[model samples]
Target: MEAALIAFATTAATLSVTVVLALLEFRRRRREAVQARREQIVGRVLDTLERATRAASRAPIVGWWAPNELEYALLLPRLLAELPEQDNAVATWVARRIQHLQAATSRREQVAIGADVAAKVVQWGR
Candidate 1:
């Protein structure tokens, strides 16, 4: 009976240690995943902003309007993707700018301005 009790206690201690190690590993992995995702999202937003800026700069200025269109399909997703979830003020500001850009006839010019607006949001968020 004494030997059996000793074995049981030892096994329980070992199991507890293993569980703690597993939990720590799981938390570490989750943190890594979240960090990686944030990096990816930031990269994508930066890329979009860079592309739009380049496109706008390269576009022909015609009668106070840029010739190039703002390619909503490309811009919207990346902007929304980079936008953090918790900040309603930032989100609303961005949403309003996007709405204006979407409604504008000179989308390229609008998008360039939008990038400035987005940069402000990024600054605020950080």
Candidate 2:
């Protein structure tokens, strides 16, 4: 009977450990999935922004002539919102750039802000 009890206890301990490990692995995978999704969103937004900036630079005028600001403004805020609280500097910089891009009064101002935004987006990729 003692031998049987020891075997049962060993089995129980092994099962418990297996369960704990499985749970931990599940949690880790879930976290990684969430992070991947976030990065995908950010990447897409940045790509769109980069394309917009390129288009703007090639255009004759830089004011509201660029048709991308409306879409960019909408997408950028969402990306910023998804960023972790620890990334406040990035969030703040993007927010300020978006605001400046939107409020730019002259063609020169728009061009300058667009250049800054392009440079920042490139930096973020690294």
* Over 4 Å off, model 2: 61-65, 80-93, 104-126
Q: What are the candidates' C-alpha RMSDs?
A: 4.8, 3.7
Off by over 4 Å in 1: 59-69, 78-93, 99-126
- Tell me the lDDT of model 1 at 82: 60
Residues 6-125 of candidate 1 have per-residue lDDT tens digits of 999999999999999999999999988766665665555556556555655553554235322354456555556665576445546655765665566665666667677658755763
Evaluate model 1: give its TM-score: 0.61
Query: 95, model 1: CA deviation in Å?
Result: 3.5
TM-score of each: 0.61, 0.66
Window of ten residues with lowest summed lDDT in model 1 = 63-72
**Candidate 1 colliding pairs:** none
For each candidate in the order shown, give its overall lDDT on alpha carbons.
0.63, 0.72
Our model 2 lands, by Cα RMSD against the true structure, at 3.7
